[model samples]
Target: MASELIPNAFLASPRSVRSSLVSRLLAAALLTIGAIAPALAGELLPLADKAVVLAFGDSLTSGIGGSGENYPQRLATLIGHEVINAGVPGETTAQGRERLSTVLRDSRPGLLILCLGVNDFLRGVPEAQIAANLGAMLDLAADASVPVLLLAVPAPGASQIDPLFARLARLGQVRIDLHAMADTLMQPALKAGLVHPNAEGYRQIAKAVAQSLRDGGALISR
Candidate 1:
């Protein structure tokens, strides 16, 4: 059975919202009612050891609407370690694949948290190609013996990418369906269409990631 957990509501500081517009009332509600999933695995890695968490993705990972409330930074505190934010605004899976080598070379993180593909959606890129890019990235990580956590993208509001995510999951990638958690991330305050997450959004993503890591046998409990 799927686990059920939600985060308490809190006001998110205003930040730039790019893209589609959301209703103010709705955005407000989302920020106030955001929920989080349960932590999946329990201490896959020793708590005393430091983990290099690489946050790879587009502007959403860049903290687009959240100033400093990016998921990776919030995750650092949650996981108690240094998280390297490797997200670039307007980057697609293809660009991410092209730059993977440099990111890996520099970060060499023990744990990699990949959140991408939003740009691809914006550009109407084929889902198959997007999946291919993701697969290539995962393959590279596998070759390096680095554990990977793949965050699934939202289904473009009425468009779902579960099939793509499932394909990646079948290949042994630890997957978290951020799409399914969108309700928790969406509120009255999030009228902007761009792929930014508010504080509640970050909390939901972080919680889902933490849970997936725990369940996938990738992390250790405190």
Candidate 2:
């Protein structure tokens, strides 16, 4: 069940849609959501004691279309730490993979929240290449002994997440929040444009991530 994967990951944000029609649509669409199976046996190196959280991704993670507050910023408050925003606009997975080592060396964060691959998907990049690049980043994190939390980005307007993210999560590289992006981007009111989200939308994403961490035992309840 999805509860095993993310523990109530299907709950939609209250502010995502305003209209009754949109709300009903969003709710119906997200009902088909998929979970990233928890396949890891070994635990992460205690995320609660970790001081810094590095949020890595493209424009969505950068606060584009948001009012200067991105999900990472919102997440910092929720998690009680600084979340280094390493977001680069228009970046694809390949480019992000190329730059990740340097960012990792510089930030040396205790937790790495990866929210990538959307640009690659939009650019029509082959799925295999996208997967390979994402896998490389995960490998880099493992090599550096840093823990990871993957935020899955579904194809735009898609109700269900692609199986690719689930496959990657199955590798035990990270605990994956498999539905936040899909839910955030699918709602018209929550979106700033076709791909990016507004400020409140980013907050919704942050809240979902915080919840996922709590459920996975990376964060203790306050």
Query: How many residue pairs clash in all the candidates, one count each?
Result: 34, 0
What is the clash tally of candidate 2? 0
Question: Which sections of candidate 1 miss by over 4 Å?
Answer: 1-48, 177-194
Looking at model 1, which ten-residue stretch has the lowest summed lDDT? Answer: 4-13
Q: Identify the leading candidate in terms of lDDT.
A: 2
Error of 1 at 5 (Å): 19
Whole-model lDDT per candidate: 0.60, 0.73
What would the per-residue lDDT of candidate 2 be over residues 1-222, giving only the tens digit for each residue?
111242212122232332332223223334444554455443344465647889999998999999887998999899887899999999999899899999999998888888898888788886666777777787677667667778888877667677677666554336677766677887889988888899999999889888776766667544
Per-residue alpha-carbon lDDT of model 1 for 141-213, expressed as tens digits? 6556566666767646544444455445433334445542354335536423445666667766666666655
Query: What is the alpha-carbon lDDT of model 2 when measured against the actual structure?
Result: 0.73
